[model samples]
Target: MIFLMVELMLGVLISVAFISLLERKILSLGQSRKGPNKALFNGIGQPFSDILKLFSKEYFKFSVVSMKFYYFPPLFMIILSFLSCLIFPVVGGFLNMLDELIIYYLCLISVSSYIVIYMGWLSFSKYSLLGSYRGASMIISYEVFLFLLILLMLIYLLSKGQLFNFLTFQSVSGLVLLIYFFYLMFMGVMGLVSELNRSPIDLLEGESELVSGFNTEYLGFMFSLIFMSEYLMVIMGVLFLSGVLVWFSLLGYFVCSLIIVMVVFFRAVYPRIRYDMLMVIFWEIILPFALMFFF
Candidate 1:
């Protein structure tokens, strides 16, 4: 168990590094620029170098910030992000050990939401506070749709007596079912992307307005922790969706990579949508489409 857990953590860290590199490269290509080419193997070593540089930097905290609150939120954020991976059913059947996977996941998300608000408030900065407010609103907007979709999947799995049995779920298919599955997958991916505050919907870090969002005051190791936690969540989201959409482990990996690439593509091609338009799209369009699935 210990070995598996260690392996999982290592895999997650390495994956996050490469995902960062991939995103930088793709975004650079989109802008007609070469990104991270200075590092070894055509910038393959860039992420690691960046991580090392972040850790080597001097850490600083403002005098007005409460030491406990200021320090704890980033740690909590990263820890919760790590715990979110437990439901993935990867390595040594860790997920099987948990009976209430969905409940656990939802709980983690709820707690992380509070942590985001706390991180912003602890900074005692107007920019951070505003970002937190935007982050909270964006999270709330998509979380309902995400929850409904997950609940729908859970109900289907329960009715089929195949809860957590993703392989079996993928095997039972038809044209209608395939189309429906793809639709849900699309919705799920968008929800995950929005939930993670990725590009196009990244209102939290709207540099034009929020000035680095909730982590504006964070620096050095602290900032890196928050940064890493975001990417880790990205990997977790991709893997979870892949498990639901594909059967074989190898195929699931391919699907995960494909999804990550798709996310990077969106980040490169699309400009951030306006905040009101974001809320309207979710509340009026996406939410209604998701609700129709229940009927």
Candidate 2:
């Protein structure tokens, strides 16, 4: 088990590094700008350089009265992010370890809410607090829709006498379910973007408004942990959003990469959605339609 976990950790780290690089490249290509290309081999080694630079920096902590709250969130973010990744493959095999595996994974995914809330509240800065509140509200709202969509997906999968795993989702067969599936995927991807605090919905880290949001005060190695956590969540979100497409096969990876590209595409194309508008979209538009679709 230890060896397996070590292997998984290394694999996940490598994947995250490359995904970050690819995301930068994709964004640059999309926006018609030069991306990371300075470190080594046309910036192929940028991720490694980033890792080294972050490690070389000293960790900084805010002088919060409560030491416990100040330090725990970033560590919590890292731990839960990795756990969420591990739970993916083990979901089908470890039913005894967790009674409701999907719920368990959802908790792991959404636990970042607490971290966000804490970073906002615990920090003395009003910007962090405000950003955290917005982040928390947005995440909680969309998470409900995300959970329901997953349940709906499981039902649809089961109707075909399939297990509730992505491995069971073959290429689309029928038109009706396919349409329904895309609708659900649309909801899922939107929820994922909200969860990761990505563009158009990235109110928490609105640089123009809050000057970097929750982690505004964090610098050096401390900031890297927060940054890395977000990227890890991106990878985790891609796996969750891809769902049945996340198999141990070539097709599965292709599908996963395609979905991830769509995410980056949103970053390139869309402007940030206003906080109030985001709330209306989720509570009014997404939730109502999801309820209707599920029933």
Candidate 3:
């Protein structure tokens, strides 16, 4: 078990590194520019080089009140993101008890949400505070839709007396349910992206207004940890939707790859939206639609 866990963690780290490179390459192509081809193997080693750059820098203390304030949040963010990934069964080699989906998701959301609040509160800047507030609220708002979608899936799974089983579509109703499930899953993915503070909804990091938002005071290795945490969250999101899309075969792989591509496409194509507009989309639009689906 320990070996499997270690292997999974290593795999996640390597995948995340490559994913970072892929995102840069995709975005660069979209903007008609070359990206990160200077490193080893035509920039295949870019993530490692970037990590080395961050680690070589001196970790400086800002106007933080205590050592705890300076260190705890980023460490917790990294740890929580790690934990979220560890709990999910990403690789086929390891076996996890399939019944803990609810518990796992609840913990993932709670810890992820707290990390944002922790960063904002610890930073001791009004901008961080405000960004944290917005981030927390936005996350909580979208969380309702996410939870509803998950609950609907759980209900279906429970009725079938199976957990995380997506291949048993043996009827017309089942087919319809599968379609609806993916529809809700897409919405869930959007909510997850919002929680991760990706582009198009990155109001928390509104540089024009918040000056990098909740992470304004973070620098060097500290900032790298935060950045890695964000990447891990993105991985978690892919693992999640892919897990749901798993049906009979290795479709999860295709689903997972598609999601990463879609996220990069979104970043490349979309502009950051207003925070209020985001809130409206979540609360006034998504919530009601999700509730209708739930019923």
Cα lDDT of model 2 overall? 0.75
lDDT of each: 0.80, 0.75, 0.74
TM-scores for all candidates: the values are: 0.91, 0.88, 0.88
For candidate 2, the per-residue lDDT at 228 reads 83
The ten-residue window of minimal lDDT in model 3 covers 166-175
- Distance (Å) between predicted and true CA of 207, model 1? 0.8
- Runs of candidate 3 with Cα error greater than 4 angstroms are 90-95, 161-178, 244-249
Cα RMSD to the true fold for all candidates = 2.6, 3.1, 3.5
Error of 2 at 175 (Å): 12
Residue 110, model 1: lDDT of 74
- lDDT per residue, candidate 2, 1-295, as tens digits? 6566667677888888998899899889987999999988899999999888887887555565476767778888888877776655534443324436567777787778878888878778989988988876777688888888767766776787865543343233122233656776767778888888888788999999999899887766667778888888888777655544455567558767877888888998899988889989999999998898756
**Which lDDT tens digits does candidate 1 get at residues 1-295?**
7687878898889989999999999999999999899889889999999999999999775789887778899999899989986765555676645557657777887787778888888899999999888877877799998888777776676777774654333333211233556776777778888878799888887899988989999889999999999999888777666654443556556777888998889899999999999989889998998888777
Q: Model 3, residue 145: displacement in angstroms?
A: 0.8
Q: Rank the candidate models, highest lDDT first.
A: 1, 2, 3
Ranking by TM-score: 1, 3, 2
Q: Relative to the unseen true structure, what is the C-alpha lDDT of residue 32 in candidate 2, on a scale of 0 to 100? A: 90
Candidate number with greatest TM-score: 1
